[model samples]
Target: MTFRHAADPVAVTADNWIHTSVLVLNASYEALDEIAADRAVVLIIGGAAEAIADRESYFAIRSTRVEVPLPQTIRLRRYVYIEHVPHGGDQSRATLAGVLRRDRHRCGYCAGWARTVDHIRPRSRGGPNTWDNLVACCVACNTAKADHTPEEVGMRLLWQPKAPTHRAKQQRKIWRQLAAGHA
Candidate 1:
């Protein structure tokens, strides 16, 4: 079923409110991870968790016997032990969107708004798509630097490209449970 979630001036009609995100917190008020709305509701109903913060807009989900306010944040009654997992290393393969996000969509050559990724080493010369070799480039710079290294074209990189830092450990998952395929 759908829910009318007023995002702003535009009302976003989501296909499934059950899939909406709810922040899950440990008993000590430590943020754990995001979980599905349905699971959060189950936790609240089963007395495993309680709603710490309700949705900004007053909305209630009703059952035959109870009406629980939809939550933006929920806290568990018992502390959950979560372990950190290594997200990725510096040598990880890079994608176009990832490159743009890493560089904030600014041209590596001119620091202008960018929408394309350029290879420091041209692909024709066997440059693999890796984080350290890719940088965001604007249309003009990309076209001008076509098939040529920046030095050969007298252009300079604004910053050295590198893989993005990993997210905080707790945001990933329970390492042991995930490794054993139980989480």
Candidate 2:
């Protein structure tokens, strides 16, 4: 509810609210991103966005001029243009965690749960740490294919690997809806 400060009744401590996540929506009510609660409050107080939903239990953020409820979801007052940026292209460096997430934690060789990543062209032979060269692998598969290319071990990949696509299509659809302003 209302939090009062000992020194100044109008000031609320930001420390407690900094970790809370607030969902952000576009002007057209399309989901965009999640940001910290403090940032959401700033956007709301600055008149850049309005709170669409508040936390069930109210947490008051008090300032000299105003006191506002902490927001759970906020929508921008105006549409914000988003440019799609490609992530981790073939030549770009790939992290072990990123490769695992891209493969859905499934082994690319046997479709089993994976805990590690394997280089398609073994790192020993100078495989670059790129999206196309890495795949999620189970312990057994990684051991079996150690320091060797898939073909050398007579192993076949379940699927070809590539860089993950961004949310370009969904963003485009949201832009179209914003333009139409359909009821």
Candidate 3:
């Protein structure tokens, strides 16, 4: 469903279509090419970019209190560029769900049914939730390991999860769209 700012002067009607997951990029900053709208909100909320003022009035929605997408490009507190990062083999970012699927839902430990996730290094011990440190785990194995380090628990991982050398997630999405069209 499309959402609009409560304070918007112009109403968004049936003619205007909205799509989620629109990508935003850093135009000046030497960072990754793009991020999702949700992440863009974080950057805006964090004072990284001023909403492109020229486009604000034309946005699909407007709320004085909350952040809304500007209809026009806004200048970043630093230069920011917004672009649709196409899905392809070279892209680095992959969704959590995609990572889990790549691992085939198998616990690095026991290899039984896995529905949960485990950190190779416990978070309490300072593990960040990146793809390399995460693995699909069964409930039983997770409970068995608990908050302790793997060495402390005497458990061993069957495979070391690594970041993909090539971006498979984008390829997968393209495949899905292609398959859907054929169907």
Candidate 4:
């Protein structure tokens, strides 16, 4: 989306499309980092990283290619191990709500207004309740989808649920602060 900048006479690419950020997590359910929405789109389409967002958009990056948010979290084809960045508690694996907040409440099922989280494999089945195993779930959907897999419940997920990539949660924090503007 384009917007006219008050600071400049020329229209500028309002970071709106890129407003949403993607978090990349390690296979171990660790907070690795974050990526811009555009870059995340690239990774999702090029088959590098699978989208963990419940809802993804078909963003026209540079008006050339389109990206798809994988319904499941994807691992890199090859192991290019990076530094393992630690998040909160070593034993405290992030909850689905925490993951959703980290993901800015974007649905891991549809990228819609998500206030709840869904365990991909269902906690009742020993799903371990980890970040990679969970995604954001909206209230009505989550209620209707209690203890059932997407397939079993007849709901399709938009993207895959994987650990976040490590970039700069700081960047997201910065955005939040900027948006809040010292309120």
The best candidate in terms of lDDT? 2
lDDT of 1 by residue, 1-183 (tens): 333333434321234557567888888998877777776777788677899898776667776788888787999876667644456554446899879988989999999999999999999888779888999999999999999999999999999998875542233333333334422
Model 4 scores worst on lDDT over the 10 consecutive residues at 3-12
Q: lDDT (CA) for every model shown? A: 0.76, 0.78, 0.57, 0.57
- Clash totals, every prediction: 0, 0, 8, 27
Residue 74 lDDT, candidate 2, scale 0-100: 91
- Select the stronger candidate by TM-score from 2 and 4: 2
Per-residue lDDT tens digits for candidate 2, residues 59-127, read 898878999898879998888766555553433368898788789899999999999999999888999
Instruction: Estimate the TM-score for candidate 3.
Output: 0.46
lDDT of 1 at 44: 85
lDDT (tens digit, per residue) of candidate 4 on 1-183: 332222333322334546454555544555555555565555556555555543332333453565354222333322334534576322347675567876678776667888888888888998867767778878877887888888997888887766554443444443343335423
* Superposition error at 90 for model 3 (Å): 7.4
Q: Which has the higher TM-score value, candidate number 3 or candidate number 4?
A: 3
Clashing pairs in 1: none
Cα error of candidate 1 at position 83, Å: 7.1
